[model samples]
Target: MAAVSPREERKARLAEAVWRIIAERGITAVSVRTVAAEAGMAVGSLRNLFSTQTGLLEFSAELMVERAAARVTAITPSTDAVAYALAAICELMPLTPETRREFEINIALIAETPAHPGLARIRDHAHTQLLDLFTRIAAMLRGETAAPSPASRTNGRRLLALADGLGLHLLHQRASDDIGWAVDIVRDELHRIKSAAIGD
Candidate 1:
């Protein structure tokens, strides 16, 4: 892998600071000054990286989406489509510490969307990407090598809803300590979809 440039590293550090603040203190606590303090950087340095708090928030949110997407893309396709689908979908859940932090940041950004209308675009874009991922998974579950059909898209939306619900429940219930339950739920759902497809 190529080395990360100093400027890129600094920006990543600042973005991490933003995520930490959002995860720990909520979105309300995120600001140029606070993020600078969290990152142990000067106010001017943080400003040089991000001119405004919205810019900081947007970058952090974008980075979060990018990281999640990268992880999903890295999964090797499996003959067991159900297992492959579960692996990709589970990356979106807060099952691990890293993913839990990302989930918290995601929730915080969504909650602030009303006040920060700019964030709505990022959220919507991420939603579209996720929907597309689910559609592909739906096609895979049906053993279809062709493009996703309208029915596949519909099923994808349902799968997305299920995933969102599961993530929220896990976050609300603090179920990270026992993530097997969520994993089983997803695995069962995938099997059900596969069975339904085979039946049809």
Candidate 2:
């Protein structure tokens, strides 16, 4: 890969600062000047990188999905289907500080999508990709024998919803250990799919 220039790196830093401020203090804290302050750079310098708040937010939205895509790509599937499914679901959840910030930033971007066509496209793209990801994970859990049935597709959607619910609950400061709740839901569903595949 080509080396990133110093200017590009600074822009990435500003995007990260926007995410951090959003995660801590909501989108209300994310003006261009405030983001520049959070990034410890002059407003003029930040403006040189991004001409407007919309441009900065678009960059932040792109960065948010890029980070999640990288993590999802890095997941090594497990031999045990349930474990594998759980791992995939966890990739979409806010289990760590970085991922938590990611979730927060994505939510903030969602709010802007209505007014910004660019952001709306990004949000729509992410939705489609994540649904495909959930479907693929469901197929993996279904294993080699059976074809993917409509019920299986529905199950995949349900799993995606469950993961989103878990994320929202966690984001709203639910118990730290409530992740177990998510795991239990996935494990139960995967077990049902596995049993069906085996003619149980």
Candidate 3:
């Protein structure tokens, strides 16, 4: 991989500052000046990376999705399909402080989608990427090596909905019990798929 440049690093830090602001003060509080203050930089410096507030918001949302995609890509396949699926899906949720901040930022950007075309495009891309990830997980649950079947596609959509809903729940209700229950639900679904695959 190529080394991260100083300019890119500063932009990422600015994005992090934007997310922190969103997590603490809501989306209305994030501005170039506020983000620069949070990042300990000048507003002009932030503007060098993001010409406008919309650009900053788009970059931050894209960064969050990219991080989640990187996490999913890092997973090594294992024999236990249920465990692996749970792990992969969990990568997209607010399970940790970093991830929680990302989720919060994502939610903030999503709320502004109507005002920002760039954010709307990012949302669409994220939805498609998530469906693709879930489809792969569904195929794994069904013990398939080739293309996903129609049933598998349906199951994938269902799993994505369940996981996304669980993520929203966890965003507001952050508790160990909630996380455990969510994981159990996904595990049960994957197990059911595996059993059905065996029967077939």
Candidate 4:
């Protein structure tokens, strides 16, 4: 393979530095100068790689989601429906140092979604996909034999909202160990729905 471009390597290093700073301090800590300092590069070179502040912020957001996706994909869940689901949900949280930084950067980006034009679309897309994921997890627990209803769709969104809310809370040191709690909540809702059907 061809050698990695110096520019590309520098961009990756700076992105990593931004991620680290965001985790240690906060997203507001991420700036051309700060990241350049962390990466031990001149701000000019960092700017050359990003071209603009928005570009770097946008890249960080994308990288956050990409890292989360990789974490989720590394798991191989059991065939047991609930077991499979809870296992998958475990992947979404910042369980490791690297993932923690990733989550931190994403949370910081969420705060700037309004002021940062680059992050608006990324935030929207991330939420949309997360809800879709919840919807799928709902269907899996319910089984395909039973068609998901309008109420089921609403429930799926609620579950995702809970997960996202808890994510932000944990990022801010407000909530602790939401991963299992979230999975339990979803499973409980599923059972509650089935029970309601049985009584009907």
The top-ranked prediction according to TM-score is 1
Highest lDDT model number: 1
Ten residues in a row with the worst lDDT in model 3?
174-183
Clashes of 2: 0
For all candidates in order, the CA lDDT equals: 0.89, 0.80, 0.86, 0.71
lDDT of 3 by residue, 65-113 (tens): 8888999889988888888888898788777777767777788889999
TM-score ranking, best first: 1, 3, 2, 4
Clashing pairs for model 3 are none
Sort the candidates on lDDT, descending order. Answer: 1, 3, 2, 4
After superposition on all C-alphas, the RMSD of every candidate to the true structure, in Å, is 1.3, 2.5, 1.5, 3.7
lDDT, candidate 4, equals: 0.71
Tens digits of per-residue lDDT for model 4, 35-68 = 8899898988887788887898788787777667
Q: Which model is ahead, 2 or 4, in terms of lDDT?
A: 2
Q: What is the lDDT of candidate 1?
A: 0.89
Query: What TM-score fits each model?
Result: 0.95, 0.86, 0.94, 0.78
Q: Output the lDDT of residue 1, model 2.
A: 65
Q: Which stretches of candidate 2 lie above 4 Å from their native place?
A: 144-149, 175-177
Better of 1 and 4 by TM-score: 1
Better of 3 and 4 by TM-score: 3
